[model samples]
Target: MNRSSFIRRLSLVAAAGFASLFATSAALAQAAPPAAMRETMAIGDEPGRVSTEEVIIREGAFARQLVFFRSTEPVGTLVIHTSERFLYLVLGNNRALRYGIGVGREGFTWSGLVRVSRKAEWPDWTPPPEMIERQPYLPRFMAGGPGNPMGSRALYLGSTIYRIHGTNQPETIGHAVSSGCFRLANGDVIDLYSRVQTGTKVVIRHAATL
Candidate 1:
């Protein structure tokens, strides 16, 4: 073939190859797995952003950390020292994932062994009738999202109204603020949620000491 004819043929071949590759990519994208399209168990309720400002506590007891936890409890046990505002997950080696949390105020305190019966990500909030009676200004029900008081995830405790959940108020961490619930930062809750499954043991300390 002459020079110009040969160059034109090569250009045509290149264009056809590009078109084929594009089609294949589009097809693959369309056939993507449902899991891929579904939301991740990230800290934030916002799409494409896996974190929220409410989860950020730059320096405080509520900061997420791995600490030396001396306990005889089996691995995967969730231990909460309500007075200390600390929640610990027994890691089986004198270690635990310690997270700061907000405990319930005086009349709402409870201490006992409970199991995580259910878990939900970015869970909705519904104030119990008693809570509504106490705070008439509060919303009856709040949908789950960035604005939701339940920040990112919630672990329901033994079918009770109380839950271990994420909080919209970062300042509440390491304080007694909730009606009866234990509140963690969204980032910390997401981390905790990933480490525990439904039916996990939860021990809440209500005694004079941990």
Candidate 2:
């Protein structure tokens, strides 16, 4: 082969090698589990409607797991997985606070990165357009109070309308039953809201339960 042709063939071989390397890298990335939050609960039942008998009994089953929340130290990041109905608060030293939660409906879910931009005590309930459209009977907005859908505390997730907040409907803690927000039990939300501060990162990963 002429000098020019030999060089051209060498270039082609180099390009093919690079392509193979790129494909291998992509495959490895796919095989690795994402460094994202994982959920531990199933999606069933509705909020505010669980029977009282369950209140005492259910906690024992879930409570036996490793403790995830620590109050004595500074707050950490939080992640909520809608599909698994679980929330994870990342604590330093490889520890974390994990809690069961309720998520949105079939098509009423969202997942992305956000921060706890604001917090409230006994926050008001303002139904969003999508929420109202879903439940036409729901009021446009409900003032903050014990009876409001937003229970005792609300941790606003940055500029987005989403939130990881307390819910008046505790029965929905381990179910899929919200418009698109992450709903925690009143006690759990209160505990979390106090520990987390504004500007804490929150990642929502919605996927199948483990």
Candidate 3:
């Protein structure tokens, strides 16, 4: 083959190869599960499987931090403001450790005084019958782990099914997305689990009460 013809043929081959690689990458991206579905691997549930990037909370407002807060609740009290999507652990003297949270959506939101009835690390998840009725596709039971919708820890609230637990879906923080549970980032929830004990008071309030 002539030198110029050979060069032209090589260039075409390279272009075709590049195009194929690009197409493959795009297809893989499309095939990958969305952020919401990563954690469950189950159908019709919360977000995607957990990953380092997905686990790191990127929203500034949702990041856990100490903040100035005025409340009559005791130092150890957990005050959850559903409207603001914040769970505050009272630190006394007008300050508290605030955590971004995901609360129950519209019809699922509730408010009242309750206590921490129990705590568990990597707690197993059992979809309540009511929850199953609503989302029939959900698994009846799921073992806790990184991929579990319940993330790293759980503080059972009162005798109710509600809990303040860690969530695999960090993006859900600062949003109303649960059945009635209050969810924090795994790290934040672990910190919270360490600070509180069983029988600790939890005050849940809506925006109107605030």
Candidate 4:
């Protein structure tokens, strides 16, 4: 074959090979699992980016479970044991639905009896004055979403700046890292939110009290 003719044939073959590769990639992508099914958990700092830490928290000991609990509090009450990093919803008959939680760090920890004054789903977040003062780099206001630190739900505690809320950082569960709020994995918080309502009694027990 002449040089021009041979070059034209080679070019056609190269184009066809590239097209085939693209087609195969598209097909594989279509066959792959959905992102939601594949990614079970995400971190607050990087939303939708799954990591080993996220998987360990979501499927490890931190996952929510029903457990035998001894509490004088009536059924439907919320009990938080900050030292153990667990929150229990009194279910009567000496039982409770327990969720792993992230409590306040060091000086931020407190114990008190409070009530759920209100609730919100995917609530907007405004860093409290104190929080902003401590971490001046934080946003003044952040709209709620997957990327938002507030996560999926929030149960406001009485009139205090504290709340039992969801965190995008599932790995934070079973740790002490919050400013003062009690945080749960997004799924766990959503479950808790559905089972409680405004006016629900919340008893917070710190390490000293527990």
TM-score of each: 0.68, 0.62, 0.70, 0.68
Q: Across residues 1-210, which tens digit of lDDT does each residue of candidate 3 receive?
A: 153244335544653565456545422233433233222111124433444222434337777788999999888999988767788999999999888887744213457899999999888888667667656777898887776777788999888877988776565566555343788878788888999999999998775521
In Å, residue 132's CA in model 3 sits off its true spot by 3.7
RMSD of 2: 19.3
lDDT of 2 at 121: 84
Clashes of 4: 0
Clashes of each: 0, 2, 10, 0
Candidate 2 lands at a TM-score of: 0.62
Q: Write the per-residue lDDT of candidate 2 for residues 1-210, one digit (tens) a residue.
A: 153244335544654565456545422223333222222122211223322211211353223134544433334877665655678777756567677776644212456777788999878777666555545777777777665666778888777778877765554455554243677767777777877889898877765434
For all the candidates, what are their Cα RMSDs to the real structure?
20.7, 19.3, 13.9, 17.7
TM-score of 4: 0.68
RMSD of 3: 13.9
Q: Residues 1-210, candidate 4, lDDT per residue (tens digit)?
A: 153245335544654565456545422233433221222111122232322121213444566788999888999999988767888999999999888887644213446788999999888888667556545677888887666667788999888877888766555566555243688877778888899989999998765421
Q: What 10-residue stretch in candidate 4 is worst by lDDT?
A: 35-44
Ten-residue stretch with the least lDDT total in model 1: 36-45
**Per-model CA lDDT versus the true structure:** 0.66, 0.58, 0.68, 0.66
> Candidate 2 at 178: error in angstroms?
4.5
